[model samples]
Target chain A: MKIYFPNFFQALLLIVLFTGGSAAFANEKSFIDEIKGADAPFDNRSVKLVRPVTLETVLAKEEYQGGAFRVLARKQHIERYKCSSCHVPGKPVLVQQGFELTHGDVVINHGRKGNELSCIDCHNQEDRDYLEDKKGRKIDFDHSYQLCGQCHFRQKRDWLGGAHGKRVTNWAGDRVVYNCASCHNPHSPRFEKRFPATYSVPLN
Target chain B: MGFTKKDKAEKIIEDVLEKPSSRRTFLKGASIAMAAGSAALATGCMPSGDDSSSGEMQLRWQEYFKKHYRLMTQKEKDETVDRLERLAKIQDDIDVQIGTEPPIENVLYGYAFNISRCEGFMECVTACVKENNLDRKTNTQYIRIFEMEPGKLDPSTGDGQFYHKVPVENKFYMGVQCFHCENAPCIKACPTKATWREPDGIVVVDYNWCIGCRYCQAACPYFGRRFNWGKGEVPKEELTTKQHYLGNRKRPMGKMEKCTFCIQRTRKGRLPACVDACPTGSRVFGNLLDPDSEIRYVLKHKKVFRMKENIGTQPKFWYFID
Candidate 1:
């Protein structure tokens, strides 16, 4: 009995500490709830206290339209340019076999001089429909923001927080925002310089 | 009796009294004038052959005697709206829907302009003109987008009428409109109390009550107000039929008009036309009281400034650089 008594006291001490810690946590949670309830006066449309951004939340998958957020795949946008129609299923090598006949008119002026990226760098070799991320993960065309977010983290954060990107339909109701692909082309991401709308009045 | 001097003076006075200069004659003329005035008021100048002339006369009298929009009863407001709608149909041959939506409780409308995003597109201005049905004849544009060279924040130095292709190197764009100031000087300067700020922070002018004094226009430092020099000549196809009682309802000549933040649309939980028309997503508008709203987010997260902040207008509109 003497030998087990000290061990028993230690076990009891641990249990007390655990219960006290959990009780304090529960108290904190209820306090937050009380604050939220008090803040909302009429409709439950009080300003939500936004949590601080974390790497995990930034990298999390986006949910849109009651499904996973998606962008139109490259193949879908250009229906006329089908790889299966030109190249056979087994033939992975197509550069030497009359590449100029099909893609001669295509202009690829993207990227800096000498380090211009090729189509194969971002596109999946086996499946022409899918895009390959840096880690070789096949990504849906709709979730192209993910591919862009890998490099442009700041823009991604802004887009998520209603700072960047265009919101459509109504601002008061459902938050249906456009994806990065909707505004910019993946091959040419930079916005083109164009003539603006008609002027309000003639300049003096 | 004729031989005496006093008798002669009395005879001359009687002669003058017998003429039209007598007090009785004056009283008779005054009664005739009163009767004519009353008749004019009752029948509206001249009797018309039209079937709706009586109804029109009654409507005009009612409109003339109607109280300010703020003091009007619910029933009175309804009757006025109906009359105005009918008048629009008769005069312009266009169906206009005028809403009397009261201010939403706890909703103080706020606007945020993003300078970094605005490319001097003028899309917002065009959309605003079409939506508000501004007078195209005088080229009265409520929104004036200023193109400023970098390093200069002063609007005075910016050119509001730049015609060159935009996104000009080292130049930024900023748009200005009626701020709907909390301490609106226009309201104070109005000699007739024609203009006042609504509960939702929208400063509105009663078109019928304004006397073309231009006091409000002179009082405004931002030059946001516009005076109608002539009747607004809106084409039948161009006229915006959807309107509000205190908003875009077509104004008569010689009345002050300004942007009401698209009250007809905004009060119905829709965005202002400018906000919708902005291709660059430069404009943000919402209830300032609501913490979760987009305007609140922009106010909290962005570095915002009100134009002429030193004037102490306490404008609800804010400008920000990205």
Candidate 2:
């Protein structure tokens, strides 16, 4: 129909088309944005907050083996450090160093027989200071995790991944955790059963 | 004994009745209006010294009318938290810091308990009670450690009160608290909207908004909620001064409360008191969304299961064994 139309009608048609096109454009862009947003993963490191209470220092930490945590150094907390001060090479040490005198209360019951694994198996006999791994590699007292990691590799892997051991004080920031000895008595690894601190049947 | 407007009006009526003169009736009506005006004036100029009367009456009034914590603006939250701390100082003489830190963005908390590792020491129980300031008189613990036998994963079939020794022969220990379920039934059951799961997945209760109806208590299948039957009694010395508005500040009597995963500590990047207190290192808590977190490792690598998966609660809590 070749009927004449006012100029206003033509402009109105353009406005309608442009408005509808803009809406479609926005929807198309928004759909892509939604997909991208869903794909983007959130990282825990985005949290900048650190633990207010910590027993760890940056001076002594090893980034957890390919993990997102740091293991706190243990040597600083070790009692009777500098094993060399009390022991000479090829000499009996536990008695002379007052290790037995001071720790007279503790008994080493880790293995079935004491002969299977002696102090020198883990503790360096040649150098009373550094701990010895199974391969006779000298491990720093601070890094005794490497020593414990040998025999109890499963626990070591979990500890490194932060499933088997204790986190120091807080959960976030500079993720520093306690070494194996912090919870387990290295000499006597098994925990003793004891009475609960508070006991009440919660269920009525 | 306080001079209220009603008391003043009663006195004015008594004086008018004692005379009973008909001519003064019109004047009595006029005088009553005057008394009303004066009563308003008197109250407007009331002494500031009355503020010292326990400070609780004022706090209680504000607390009574407060909006649900989720609906409150930051400013309103701050005002209430300040009033609560001041009330504690005035009434109990204990200086408490009530934190109102909101959930961190993009973080969802999840907890994992190692069934193979928990030794039934109840260290978590002791730490939870001390940390949350639970009722000393009643010993209302939020976390219950059940001594379970083989093939019995249910709490009803277990013993929560084997006090003789932990890790009993042929038995394993299981600790149950609020799993902070993804689809929490308690939140759905609450008539007042007092309890809700935060963005971080830790279900919290606004202490003031709770109506003490205990509907949530009845609705929770895991027995995750507790009703304060009596006023929580913690010795002034034993009370934990560090508190959270939605956590273990000071619970009102008859409100439903459950484990908030130690919101005061957790929101600040600290582990829950129970996790920190465990001698066996069984409890693991972290951001659920974070793939590298210990909890995620436990979920992905270990044979893990929730308490009642068939109910479709989708609890963030999981139990695993070595």
Candidate 3:
């Protein structure tokens, strides 16, 4: 009994040390002060309590010296979307019959208003909108199928119809749905044809 | 008298030899389906080896790559075929054999029609949408049947891009859709393996799997596909909601979609609604494999051409000079 009692006490001591230590360590560490002394709200339930470092801060880090969010945004637009096809910013968004920028107008109006919410503000590394695969990753942007589900609910319906994305099921099985960004790059969405339809034959 | 009986036997043999089997019928129907339903069966079906006792098989992208339908492990493919059969039974009571075929390789399918032959009838476009179950609000048609000038190929060349008048003078009508290509750039641009080309050379989009990023739309040389900007309007009464899981399944908003060569209708043993709807027999569908088929004959002898042949996409859809 004496020998077993000492071993039991040791085991209890270790359990208390590990559990109590983790609990105390988890006691809301604040990093808002690290960045301009602002009080950033933390979700207690989540295991990821480390204060998020934004693109703004990542650029300020020693590793990312020349990374400017504004510049990156401009580059992505110029390189990816043929921005010149429509708006010159200072100029009006080009609009004609059949081709309208109505959707763009809504997004630009609601999504990007205050300078406070930049491009990366909603779409960044920590946005849990996609699966988090930071350091050891072969594929970048492991987006959750649900992330795009937040905005385009209707497409999600068509997706269920087997009309939109990659379908990985038997013809008769319960349909599996994919996320929006899987097939589309959210920045510049357009339909692509394999070949130019210059052959002007008409199907009556 | 015995010699005459031998001659009669000879005549019976000749009659049996002369009789044609339903295989010819099957071939004719199959050919029509390939072109019309290229979009629908882009993934679901391939011809398999004759195993009368067994049923159809489902194939994954990887398994599809390893074997043509005939060479596939029957156990694996049957699991899928059985599921499809069950689904078909649920949808309808007809004896539907989801037959398998060898994986179609390298060959691409495309179409080019003579606008001169087309009237103002929007049969082809309407047929495609109804056959594919497009969102009613968007009224999505994979092929855009446009009314253009007789001499001009581009619809946007001369007139105000949108004209309210119906059947304007000297205007030629053209149907433009995905030119199922051997090399599809849109497939390359997708971050996920959502949209891709099948072995038989059809570019198909998985509506359910699409992320609605629109990169594929931008990558395409022809703006054949469209995006669901909103929940497409479907009049509840008019919705022919029978969904083909891979074919004209209803599309959702934000995802990119395009014409899939009437995949749903063609995959089954039937003519595409567009083909059936055409008042003029302008569309010709046939098996490239069969030398005697009409399409094969046209391709071999006629001056067949496709859109953007210069890009080397090797489109299966073609147009003979009007």
TM-score of 1: 0.73
Question: Which candidate comes out best when scored by DockQ?
Answer: 2
CAPRI quality level assigned to candidate 3 from its DockQ score? incorrect
Q: Work out the TM-score per prediction.
A: 0.73, 0.80, 0.41
Q: Please state the CAPRI-style docking class of candidate 2.
A: acceptable
User: Weakest 10 consecutive residues, lDDT, candidate 2 chain B?
Assistant: B1-10
- Per-residue error for B88 in candidate 2, Å, reads 1.2
lDDT for A38 in candidate 2 is 36
Residue B164 of candidate 1: its Cα lDDT? 73
Please provide, for model 3 over A52-144, each residue's C-alpha lDDT reduced to its tens digit, 9 standing for 90 to 100. Answer: 222221111111111111101122222324334443446553346214543333232223447333343334333322232223222223333
True contacts kept of each: 0.26, 0.60, 0.00
Task: State the lDDT of candidate 1 residue by residue for A36-154, as single tens digits.
Answer: 33333233123221221111112226753122322223335554556556555676655655455665554565578678768876767777666788888887665677777777877
Summarize candidate 1's per-residue lDDT along B1-322 as a digit string, tens digits: 1113324643564455345645655555665565456546656655665535555555554565565676568998999999888877776678988889887766678888888888898888888889998888887888889999888777779988778777888889989899998768999899877888776779988887789999999999888899887688878798888889888888889999999988887776677889878877788887676555566667667788888888777788888866
Query: What lDDT, from 0 to 1, does candidate 3 have?
Result: 0.46
Q: How well is candidate 2 docked (DockQ)?
A: 0.27
* TM-scores for chain A over all candidates: 0.56, 0.66, 0.28
